[model samples]
Target: MPETIWWKTGTVYQVYPRSFQDTNGDGVGDLPGITARLEHLAWLGVDAVWISPFYRSPMADFGYDVADYRAVDPLFGTLEDFDALIAEAHRRKLKVILDFVPNHSSIAHPWFVESRASRENPKRDWYLWRDPAPDGGPPNNWLSNFGGPAWTRDEASGQYYYHAFLAEQPDLNWRNPEVRAAMHDVLRFWLERGVDGFRVDVIWHLIKDEGFRDNPQNPDFAPHQPGINRFSQVYSCDRPEVIEVISGMRAVLREFGERVLIGEIYLPVERLVTYYGPDLEAADLPFNFQLLETPWQADAVAALVAEYEAALPEGGWPNWVLGNHDRPRIAARVGDAQARVAAMLLLTLRGTPTLYYGDEIGLGHVPIPPDRVQDPWERNEPGHGRDPVRTPMQWDDSRHAGFSAVEPWLPQTEDAERRNVDAMRDDSRSILTLYRRLLSLRRDHPALSVGGWRSVPLPPSLATEVFAYERFEGDETLRILLNFGSAERSIPLEDDAAKQETWSVLLSTRPGRAGEATGNVLHLSPDEGVVLRAHPSS
Candidate 1:
């Protein structure tokens, strides 16, 4: 068999370490916990596992605020534990992608501590620092994504440091060559240890507008939007210079051949495509967040998909995401019935699919009581908490949903007792079963995995509720139909010759319904999705 480049034609499952599993009875998940769970990933048949940050931190912004890049926090485990995880995952034929936070470092990081020690320190320029405006306010009108101002005054150093997130995460000055070189060394540290790739966090925010210009007020700002949206981020983020920084990081990956680089970027499709770099020299996959932010409507999502496909730069691959540690679960956003269709769409889409940890078992938003809230963003911003979505994974019906022996650091999903891996494993109608079937189909059929794609047009009456597409390689064409509405919809094959071609149901999101339709016009149930292959012409 020829060597296969898995990143281009495989799915990734995102594992938030602190919530994955706990083996030490410390109410927190650890590296050893992840190693023990590798078998589950292999069973699911994912190509790679993307582990979110597990580095040393002050727990201010969780692991996103990295204090030490090379060491795993004792709360997680020792370096030996991480090496064991890598070995186990590889032994099971799974690639490991580590979360890399190069945009910022925790205030407690030795580099940040040294940089803030004095104005004349050699490391002073490693972080962004500026004097306050004449009125003794922030140097600019920058805002944090979490909430409030992005700049915090440092009394000891008499300067205000800028952060794209919490003040605990000080933005690194990538313009400083020393800062760039230091981050490169961090990447090397892990690559030398046999890590496969990196999911770079907030990569678009690496370089800001050099002049420190005040962000202009947004004409469309609304009270319902987050405070960070009060001003457009033109000056504060997604700067043109950031691509050069991305290219430099890509060069480092080249040093370790076959290692992929996935960037966490939230810019517009046009701007997002630029990060691919000329000749595809930037990120191997700049994460596509369109599905996460777009309105959950059939026509709206269909247009977004086609638009994204049209915008891809030559030789650049596409990726998709519905939820992650930062966003709400899809089941909560689209309801349970529609989540099934989403599963079909994600698995059959024309690019890499990233599955959030608990999404497979239909985990929804779990409320976090005031005292149990661990996310600092939630503590600082009352209504905008992410703690609800970062709950523990539900493994069984045991206490804490079998994620830990004691209460978890955060709450598990409200229905985890009934909806968990153990409960769904044996049920053919469960969402987990649908996911397993979809993954298996993708593995068995090339038309569904690496085939060419074309959008199948629907009548105007069914346009808003239905999305139809087809993928074909040679004579094999797989037609996919999804109903986003609550009412059933019937779709007729458009072409006369193609319509006459007999078809068989390969799978359906609705269980016990496969192999039911054998006619030209396919009947679809409410919130249903199905995949069919045209029989060879006799």
Candidate 2:
């Protein structure tokens, strides 16, 4: 039998620190707030919590622009508060993974501050900087992901610095051995603090092409798309040298045994899998966001899952992400009913699953009033703001949804009055209940966790709307059936199992479906998902 790995099989729950919970009535969540809410995660049955950035920062791009890697931001708490968070999480048998932003640092960081001081400063080469073009324009045609030219001129020094996101966040020169060493120490600092692992932010952007070339224009660029899409980012991101940097980070985690490295790479599956490196030396799990990008159709999703499964390197574990701090919620993307199916699909899949905070309770996008907007991207590129999905978590119907005594930094969903953890916990058929059941099932069954996965072929009549797959290990076999369409459909299992054998419904999105017996043909309600346990008919 293969050795069981915690990160490979455990489920991950992402907590957007600023919005998760607030204990000090400061209108923002703190580390102590997270420690207080650990019971909710433990009761929900998740194996780990991946907390987003809480590092000391200037808040230009929120905590992603780090001013200090080792110190916890005062807005969140102190270093002692972080230590307490991990210690308490470990006490609850839940692992804690921190968001590690290595690609860039806040312009306020001492390192960047020193580097931008002067052209002849010893730290001048620590960040990407160049002289103006002959036309006195920015250094290159490379565009920032947050819109505008990637280069921000240092008015005092007359040199331009590059940033992939906000100008307040400067891209570090990964080619600099000192920078690499410094970032490596950052990992060691957390690992030594007993952090279970790290979710490396924008990991693919760690290294830029050495030639400092202009990114080619994207032929498919549209007027409505974000300006970054104007260029293909060929020379700006996912450079080959980034793999070596990933391996170095992986080596640091290796020094602290049993630690995991999860990289956030926004690329196609074929390109995404390469970060695993030869023999899996890079990220332990390069996050798989296919579910977030694919069309909400059975056929499209089926193909995506198959493509991702095929693209994984040998022995590389697979993972699925339904939502995150950066993307729209699943409920908003596919509607409430389909979001239930998404939960089933995520937890029942063969590898690790990351549950975005508030997703378990069916939180959707909340309309943000212009005056309340906090995300800098919205100010930079109107319409591309992620503030709607990064709102405060809905814990109850209390004022501020019980997240804080005062108003939160962001607004809560309009339906938070009834759609909250406290309310959902009392309702048997709530999306939150469905999530807990799915997670509980994963915990009780190896076939659902560290099992083998195979797609089940469906007949042409049901092929476009219904997706089915099997998870099996030893004598345990479970079949998952999902109906992505709005219309009810029936599918037969003749191709999957013997026609005479009956399958027992282990769990279903719809109430009263469990414990029911179904034969070769299974009837499914619209936008419903079911898990069936197969055994020989006595």
Candidate 3:
């Protein structure tokens, strides 16, 4: 890897706009607030910021269901505010990537409104619409990702429309060229506005099965929610035609120099890699979500790393995301103590690492009272809601967790005082400090940022509890060792001759240590990890 490779040398920080900062005292984060915080992010040492959707929407699915793709949402400030934010980010040498919602649009959108007005409307074919069964039931057994039936009936037209999500989010008919052109126009809108790139939402679901056939039944479905065990949805998403559309999107991105396009795909490694396209004319980065699905084990993680590396496309850029607005924080998923180890693994890996908001401070999931839950998915499915992860970011120990002057849209965590940026900024041992150090180290070292990765097989005695790998660039080699278990472990380096020389520890989770190394054999405490670079002079 070379430093010139854009994806290899940058750290991306994801910001969930609504919970980031609120300057208007209206209890919602806006673009102006983000502009005000550009200096803080620049000081923290990130190369780019991926802001979640803030486009004009109906709030049915927050900003995911866009009603107007070209304008900023009123709740998130004006178009001028967005321009200021982008300008400020560029001034701080940070790239700004806006979220692009292309799979569906709010029903209130003018296109959908016209499409659903009547069967004779010119835009009727823009969205998926079909006749109902003779018995007045849905056309097929498709199910929404959120819950319930995927199709909603329209009384005026005597038909039903397909929606893989909420009914208010009508799925766009990608089979229509007009719809594709319209989406491309939306892309041009942001590109012309000087946005560095886009984080495409549900990119895989842009096209559906052309035949509109019924999906297979999911035999392993649980009874926790309605339609959980109903259909497999194999044909409803990730259609082959998606690749062609993505190629077109990549073509548009090429017109702008050094612009990036990342896709949100939840498929397996094999399917996910296809989003890179056959000729590398697709998403610049298809999110590697192995951390989201993999079991937290030494062997499991090691195997997953090897598998993902092997599966990547030729010349394809790699990226990793441990936490996001849609998923629980890595700290809560693997316990607070293991969070540091997770961060080390993320930063040391061979890809651009994306850190979710508040993850640096070890923010846990906020308990959303049943009545206070605002997430539509969680509200519809009480037990399986993602509200816990989507809570307001804890900035300080204020009444509203310093997120808003009034009550936040979502409830703040009770322990926000102890787990906020203000408190952790001065605490040397806090997770925030560890993140800052690790990010700084990654930025300072070309070996850590753009080096080739090779898994260092530990001795059988150490393999069960320890996961280690070597990242090399020319003659320089950096070894990263992590103990996934809760006990002391010592691992012998397989290449004893290579390790005979003294090594300088670059970074570690253990406190009060900087560049300390002993010999070929190294000792690690429970959940402790270190990054060591072999010293050539010694």
Candidate 4:
């Protein structure tokens, strides 16, 4: 039998470069700083690390606005530094995935700069541009993700350029043959440098409606939702033509054997599966962000997972994420105790799992003061900034949480002193210990790694407050149970005959929970989660 790909069976850890570590004393994390901390990840047992964009940029939208896809940004150190980081990570048996932003580039990029110079410029077709509507406003009703109109008028060219995100990041015209070719070359550049894969950013927006048609309004949009939610994004993104563009990127990855491509697509489960392409030619994983965005209720999360599993096409694989740099931390979303349960769920689920940095230590969103805010989105839309979750890593109780010698670019969480890698390492009851335990169990047991997932029935009374699922591989089966409520509950085990058999506790969220039992009912404390191996023999 052929061995499964690392990305398929391994967990990926995401590191936000600016906040991971700082070895330069400049209050900013660089590639070398990441290199210095590779041991921590190896100790934590993550299978891979996906670093966000670190390419040359003008700091418009952090590194998301790419000025030079081919060069390493000075803030992140030289190309040599990135090379060293990759070498060190591989030496520790970890695969490295880089963030690829094909939807747009920094406005200062030469292609965009030349395109704006004149309508006749040779590079004009490299980016999306359109003449203003009769009203002399934007070309369409498309809105920028940061807020306001998506099109910024280019006065010199008597036209407007479209930007799905910040005006500083102009959308690339993937419809153009030259634009597609250039982006493919960018993939080759990284592959040649030995990147295991890419996490393509805003991949759904690669090809928009050719007619520049207006996007329809989302009827379900609530007033409290983000401004962009007002539009259904029908014409602005997820066009049918995107499949071809994704296939092209996939072809580049195919040239390098054993590599992977992950898409950052946020769409309904049905539409999201299309990115897999016929026969799985698109992304290896169209990142499943449900665990991050779904409601925290047991029933809702279970339904989302079941729905997503049913929607996946043949040859398509699923992935899970609890949190990322763009959203609030998992601990912040579900409270500290439940975060441990989330970790257990992420690792045991039947797919590749992506772990955001700092999540293992139960890090939550930190409050950012108005005076020190650095996120552009927060500046554009006051309460919507991502700065809180992008704060420096809490490494120790030392000054600045040991992330930097001087002040960090962003503030650390208020509990930084107590909730850090150093503090959690020796404490068996800590969230970090729970994460390491879960990861180790996943690696040691096939039932927890590549097993098939099936829901285990519980009593109707416990269904809403408790989640129970069984992972089966070969003859071994592992069951995981999580309690979301604040009181103790006895979860009924449906199999009366199996009650005659013994079950051994593999691990539990609560510290010091280890034993074997033979019973029809399992007692679970509030916010408790446990994994048990069933011995079916009489």
Candidate 5:
């Protein structure tokens, strides 16, 4: 078996703080709630728990906007609560990763407050600020990701400041040496507290073009897309200088030893791979989101996997994400039946996998009433809100899905009564059980964890709807088959082992299928996925 590292071989579970669990009945989850629920993650078999930001903030962007990088928000808990949570999580052998927001800060941050106070302030250059155009309008044609112009007028300073998302969240001037040093200090602070790593938010947007040039219009821009897509962000983000900044962060992490750095990058595989840095020193994992953008068909997904696998630089570790707080759940995106198949695909792929908090029990999107809508993006662009995916986690069939005594900050899924950890843990056919089984397999088999992988060729007729691959370590080989279609299919094994090998079903998404034996031709039910171990006929 190859040398293994915790980040390379372990799965990461994302815990969205506000919606995970509420210990104080504040309708919002806090540090204590997460600490209390550490047992659940340990029981679920994930290797690490990545908690979204609990830093002090005004919640303009739901904790993405940081106010105090060093302190936990009062709403989440005090610094002591965070310390206790870390201690408990470490005691359980679960690595803790914090969401480190480096791109922007809330307008209320002391640095931003001082920057906006006056153009002549000592910290005035801490954020991106520019003079108005000759026409007395905004500085540039840049558009905010949330809606209008990326530049917001600071009437007090009589200067326009840039904000990539909301006006209340201003982009920091990363070119400033002081800003970079301060952000680096934030990473050291958490590292000192024993955090296993950080998921660096918008790491690609750290440095912008020095010339303040306007982004050219995207010729393929469509009306249905967000306004920010109207122009390609060539100058606004992903500048070449950003790599050095990341390398600096990597240097700081190396000081702490074995600390992982995960960057939240949304670029194409070509650009995304560059974040790995020279000799793989920058981002340990740039977070692959190809599964989110690809068409949910067997052939399309298969091609995506092959492409991502080919794109990785030599020795550069790969990672995969199926669902997150920002996107629609996999169950909603591909429907419930195929979600089980997706779980198999995500967990068995040749990389690290990130599981969204409620995905283990198959939580789909919950409809948000207009009165209950909370995502600021929805206010900026109607119908584009992410509230549906960011709802409270369904723990049980209790009031507020056992998430809170009072109403949850967001509503629960429609099927929370039946689709919860407590309800699914005992159900053999439930998605949660399937997840646990798969996780256990990963733990028990080196072939499933730190193994070499190769695509398994299927017959042309089955290739369009049946995707197959093999994970092998030394003498152990495991084959994974996924049926993306709704019709029953039989896949023929064409390999020349005298055509008399017996395949044992180690695990199957469909219930009552494990321990079943199959001949050269393997059968599959609609939307079913199975992991098979081939035993040569004696």
Candidate 6:
């Protein structure tokens, strides 16, 4: 591994601001609160902090439905507060990346307000709008992610507006040259504000089918409609024109040296790679969500890792995310023990790893009572709720889990005392300790950051329960072994294996067992994992 900037050497901590920490008695996390906790993040050894939307929004989809891209939402803090946060984060040697939602804007946005004011308004073409059908219905048969129709008839203009998400978040008409320029200005505004980079929201959705054709019905329709299933998105998103738009964004970031542009693309490996563009001029790293979407099988996980590595464009960086504000926490996905195993995989993988804020403490989802749910998606679709993962972060066992001095806007987990950061920080065997060790190892070892990865094939019997891979740089090589099943497993090693003699255990799920290696036969308990460095046998 060679010396590189903070992005290549350290982990990224993603903070869902509204739920991270509340400084005022407002019961919502704000920039000042984040500024105060920079030391805690610094102690965890992360090089960057990816703050989810704090931009002015209608709160229809939290901050995703942006009302103003350049201003911080009053609910979160003021522009001055955001500036303070950026200064504080940089002082602590942490880069700040904001969540840039470019695909859509809140219907209440001034641009949209004027756009809907009249069909002939200069801004009218800034959003996707179509004339109603012969029956006075939506233009086409498209569905929003939140269920129901993706189009809403605007009685004001006798036309229908397209919305890929919530009705209030009308999809931006990226086809319009003016719309593109305006969105780029939004990027320039933040870059000038000393922000490090952006985690682009729904980068692939920046373009849509020009014809507004009805999406082909899914071949396999389950209880969920084809429109809700991924198949429908083939025509609706990841369009070829999106690559050019991404390139324009890349050009914006290149103007600012080393500024990152990460895309949130949920397509297959083949299509997802295109987000990097034909000549690698698109997004720097299209967020690899394989871990979040893949099953917990060892063989399956191993295959996906290998495929993703091979698919990355030349000079394009790779990034992985285990949990996010929008999805279920990894702990709930794989159970407690496996969550630790997944952590080892995330940190040791040959790329930048992003850790969701509460994940380090092994935080589980809080069961949100119906009345307490705030997500419009859940409110619109009663049974399919996203409230569990969006619960307030638990900091201490105090009232409201220390996330707020008053009752939290979102429900706090019931077991906050047992799972809060304070309790875990002091426990040697705690998940928090494991996270610290893993991140520190990456920070200290150059090999872990820029090494070449090679899949170490395990025997069929061992492969079913254990996923193993090796990353090497020059004479140094590190082997990562993870047991994904509920059983102990071992694999035979070559007699003169790389790093056979001096190879030491770098990290392990079991407490106090890191930095020690025994022999050729590596043993891992159920849902256990280890990172080992090979020492050459002299």
Off by over 4 Å in 5: 497-501
Candidate 1 vs 2: which has more TM-score: 2
Clashing pairs in 5: none
Cα lDDT, model 5, residue 339: 95
lDDT of 3 by residue, 1-538 (tens): 2357565589999998888889998888888878877776887788999999998998999889999999999999999999999888988889999899988999999999999999999999999999997788999888898888899999989999999899999999988999989999999999998988888998999988988888997887778745644777688988888999988888888888788888999989999999999878788889888889899888899999999999998787778889998887788789988999998999999888998988888877778887887888877776667777877777778777777899887887778878888888888898888898989988877778987889988777777788999888878888899999999887665466744666767778988657676566777889998888877544
> Of 3 and 4, which scores higher on lDDT?
4
**Number of backbone clashes in candidate 3:** 0
lDDT of 4 at 99: 97
List runs of model 1 lying over 4 Å from the truth. Answer: 1-4, 494-500
lDDT of 4 by residue, 294-384 (tens): 8898888888888988898976778898899998899999999999989988998889999999999988878888899998888887788
Per candidate, the number of residue pairs that clash is 0, 0, 0, 0, 0, 4
Question: What is the C-alpha local distance difference test score of candidate 2?
Answer: 0.91
Q: Which regions in candidate 3 have their CA more than 4 angstroms from the true location?
A: 1-3, 224-229
Q: Write the per-residue lDDT of candidate 6 for residues 209-303, one digit (tens) a residue.
A: 99988887776777653337734666678889998998888898888888888899888888888788877878877888888989988999999
Per-residue lDDT for 366 in model 5? 89
For candidate 4, which ten residues in a row score worst on lDDT? 493-502
- Per-model TM-score versus the true fold: 0.98, 0.98, 0.97, 0.98, 0.98, 0.96
For this target, which candidate reaches the highest lDDT against the unseen true structure? 2
Q: After superposition, how far is residue 493 of candidate 2 from its true place, in Å?
A: 1.5
Q: List residue ranges in candidate 4 displaced over 4 A.
A: 1-3, 494-500
Cα lDDT of model 2 by residue, 1-538, tens digit: 1338899878999999999889999999999999999999999999999999999999998899999999999999999899889899999999999999999999999999899888888888999999999998898899989889899888998889999999999999999999999889988998889998999999999999898898888999999999999989988999998999999999898888898999999999889999999888899999999898899999999999899898888889999999998888999999998999999999998889999999999999799999998988888899989999899888888888999999899989878889889999978889888999999999899999899999999887898999999999898889999999889898887673443456889999998899998877899999999999987767
Model 2 Cα shift for residue 149 (angstroms): 0.7
lDDT of 5: 0.91
| Winner of 3 and 5 under lDDT | 5
Name the better of 1 and 5 by lDDT: 5
Give the alpha-carbon lDDT of every model. Answer: 0.89, 0.91, 0.86, 0.89, 0.91, 0.85
Looking at model 4, the pairs that clash are: none
